[model samples]
Target: MREAFDHMYISCWEWSISVLEEVGATKPLYPPTMLRFTKRDTNSATPGPYSYPAMTLDECQLADFSEFETFDNYCYAMFTFYQLIQQTSGLSGEVNLEVRSPRFLETVASKDDIFLIEGMHCVKFKNDRFEEKVMAHWRREMPVRTFRRKDRA
Candidate 1:
């Protein structure tokens, strides 16, 4: 359980970095960016321990969270973090960098708002021209792969 939470945070952090870069941000709107892995037990009174030291933007780089490269995956990761926080103690139940950064605000109408879904809290953002631009940027930035066909012998 602790391992899963750690994975979720790390995944979200990496995703945040990618989104920020895509939006052309020099740094997270918030400082002392919380980029690290933490694990918490199920116990309500216990505090989670940080596995890695907090990293600065220059020192932090994306990890292989490719499986969560899609927006759906990103939302799911956030939802998972929300759930984990509600289930544990000494864990922060707050909005993450990806959802609150000013860079994202340029592309969306709002980001700091939260809504309840099926009794769980989640972040919401309105789509705008920025979404289209981001898609275009991704299309240009991502590498295309091809496979060679073998000739019949």
Candidate 2:
């Protein structure tokens, strides 16, 4: 489960970086020079090292979710995971995607975070077995799967 999550998170960065490169982003943007990881608190943690990609809006060079069909779904899953943690474990932090790119924001119609959930519904997983396994783990870990997204609309 953790492995799949790590792969998907890395894929998001790689995909976004490639798109930035195609559009002639500067040298520092081509190959990521710095990568940041947050260590989980051992006293109250899940199994394994469990570090996900962490970045701030200031660090974002591009917010391109174009052409990639699974991109929104990945974002939706990530947001959902954080929400689940907060609800199930009483964690405090919030997940907010404050997209700085006005051009990218223009492409998306919905102002609400529900757009991710809705967009995810439009795409299907290619690998059935992998999807099933992941979903099963999700079900076990997170009993409450659906929640209302904060409406910015």
lDDT of 2 by residue, 1-153 (tens): 111122233444433433333333312221122233444344731222113323333343464433333433334354444334344333323223232233333344243343332132121122344344444555555543322222310
- In Å, residue 60's CA in model 1 sits off its true spot by 11
Steric collisions counted per model: 0, 0
Candidate 1 lDDT score at position 100: 40
Local distance difference test scores for all models: 0.34, 0.34
Q: Residue 76 of candidate 1: its Cα lDDT?
A: 36
Give stretches of model 2 more than 4 Å off: 1-9, 28-95, 99-104, 111-153
Those runs of model 1 whose alpha carbons end farther than 4 Å from true positions after fitting are 1-5, 8-51, 55-124, 144-153
> After aligning candidate 2 to the native by TM-score, how far in Å is the CA of 39 from where it should be?
31
- Please provide the root mean square deviation of candidate 2 (C-alpha atoms, Å): 14.9
| Residues 1-153 of candidate 1: C-alpha lDDT, one tens digit per residue | 111122234544444433333333323221133424333334633222223333433343443324335544334334443444445423444334343443333322243233221212223322243234333443454342111112210
